[model samples]
Target: MATTSDPNQKTPLEIREIQELAIAISAKNINPTMLSQEFLKQTGIVPNEWELGKQPVLGPNLSQVTFQNGVSIVAQPRNITFMESIGTKNPSELNIPNIARQYVDKLSNAEYQGLSISPKSLIPFPGSENGARNYITRTLLSPGPWQDYGKAPVQAGLNLLYQLDRCQFSLSINEAKIQMPDQSSIPALLFAGNFNYNVGSNSPQEILEQLKKGIDDWSSDLKDFQEIVNQRFLAQQQESLFPGA
Candidate 1:
């Protein structure tokens, strides 16, 4: 099946507009790295405040805004995204038309088709979870463990949204404890908001509590979305793949 809007159908600009709208709704407000620094500075875990996001060119999403003491440190995006089929549950029903699918596969494997990752096909069932793995590797969201649920919110969120093309809602929450790249672990919280780059108040304590409740709800919501996907997916393929049902 084709996966593209009719060439004569939606105008280039209109298509772009919808895409933007989707992204706008999808953007989350969670940034754990920034929050950590804020907490350290504001209440002063140490006499001297640490220079966390002062210059802010650092963490995951690479924040563009400058957070300050007077800024608000609300929940932000720090988790990976995953798709939650909003209306329809059957995934195959929502498949990209062959035309648009070309983009999916093209945008996906085009890079690897001739690169060091060319061997991507050798990886096996390039169409199953493997496809998601390879498409992400050379194409969209960063590739990692296929069907990985352990990546942070950002990665998971991207997977849910982009890979599955489902409308997703994300909530920033706190972590029990995360070890920093430096291996010097610290307790941290995640939220979406502007904060003081160096010195500000971040609700680590609150974030944890909030996540305890919020992530759970969101996770449940996603599960509901997936149930729909699985059901729908089977429905769509039954006639062709399962026939005589």
Candidate 2:
């Protein structure tokens, strides 16, 4: 099976699924031990009826709670992370960003440093593992002797960072093994994106407002990442791969 280089190809890619979406907030004064089911219910960060998937961990340095809805909130001494497995759901319906904003709103007195919104996806190569390897060496990178230095075929990964108008964006691409429901696994490429936003205000209230704005822009950022991968990178017309552009 040959991979299509036409960006406008009517056929969809083999597999494109969002694995996870996360929002991590950096704070200096948060106590992880304060996180608990009772605390969440009392602060109204989560609904009272929400049940935990497992027993909550209320340790001195780390606290975590996994909800039945696939949302997990983990709190460390200096950072709090809200994450969810998106599976096949639309990104617009994700609730982790809103929940992170709400948590910050409730704990308005913590000293916040910054926040990052991240999403990861898995896309399998159309053919075999060699086809995926060629994408990095032949398509992305120019042919050179550096690729042939090793005894075996070189396994490569790519990481890129860009400064956008609103935040710093980072993208990482690497090969991953995706486990199937039938106890099998297949090789795939993992695309991870992080949008880092810095709070420029000193007041906690102002910081909260800034975070809310960043959260609101998450959907657009996600779309930008998808476009970069599907349109710019994977969609380039390669004469060698297609045999006639």
Candidate 3:
């Protein structure tokens, strides 16, 4: 299975998905600083000093800038579960997600409903191996080495779990040889993504066998999630292309 290098290929990969997936695979172990740093890195953030209550926070510039690698890194706001930003950020880091429940009622006609966000959408998932390898490396950078101002290890764990919960474990067009749905045949899609959405974490032989038994359900979910993501991203693209009153 040859991976397509064309960025304009029918099935576009998303960095957010990669970030979410990496978070999922390394749920048990993560270094909050490195976790935050890598996440911030993916967001293309350059560090800065931020005043937080009595102390100051070192933040990065979360702007939509392309790196040497031609990746678009930006910050997206979201309704935070139990987190808050350090307030002052560079001009680039200003576009934080609106992670508040109360703001939901005041949203305009086009805003995403339910929750607010304040996210840093940085690099595309560095790919499965790199993404996984990143987590493995970061977990070793524990907070015990640094005392009072140590990064929140538990926070990283929770964030990792959150990402994992939202991530799909299958590899991208590269490693796992997943075919893009709209680009390939149904048989190809099914054959490639046989047990992707189904089965527990096991050997390939086990997953392939499980697919024989549980393919119907797995296929349905795979299609469903794919469609939902495609439509949502499509809608987002349309909105980005043309703005309305």
Best by TM-score: 2
What is the C-alpha local distance difference test score of candidate 3? 0.26
RMSD of 1: 22.8
Tens-place lDDT digits, model 3, residues 139-180: 323445333355642222111111224234331221122234
lDDT of 1 at 45: 26
lDDT ranking from best candidate downward: 2, 3, 1
lDDT score for residue 124 of model 1: 14
TM-score of candidate 1 versus the correct structure, residues matched by position: 0.21
Q: Which structure is stronger by lDDT: 1 or 3?
A: 3
Overall lDDT per candidate, in order of appearance: 0.25, 0.76, 0.26
Those runs of model 1 whose alpha carbons end farther than 4 Å from true positions after fitting are: 1-210, 239-245
After superposition, candidate 3 runs with Cα above 4 Å error: 1-3, 6-210, 231-234, 239-245
List model 2 lDDT by residue over 31-113, tens digit each.
89988889988998988888999988889999999998889999999888999877767887787877887898898878888
In angstroms, give how far residue 169 of model 2 lies from its true place: 0.8
In terms of lDDT, model 2 sits at 0.76
TM-scores vs. true structure, each candidate: 0.21, 0.84, 0.19
Q: What would the per-residue lDDT of candidate 1 be over residues 1-245, giving only the tens digit for each residue?
A: 00112132232122110010000111133444453444434434212432333454335554332233212122235321111111222323321122122222222211111000000000111113223223323344455555456554222222122222222333222121222333332221121111001101225444333322332233333344334433632234333222233
Candidate 1 residue-pair clash tally: 42
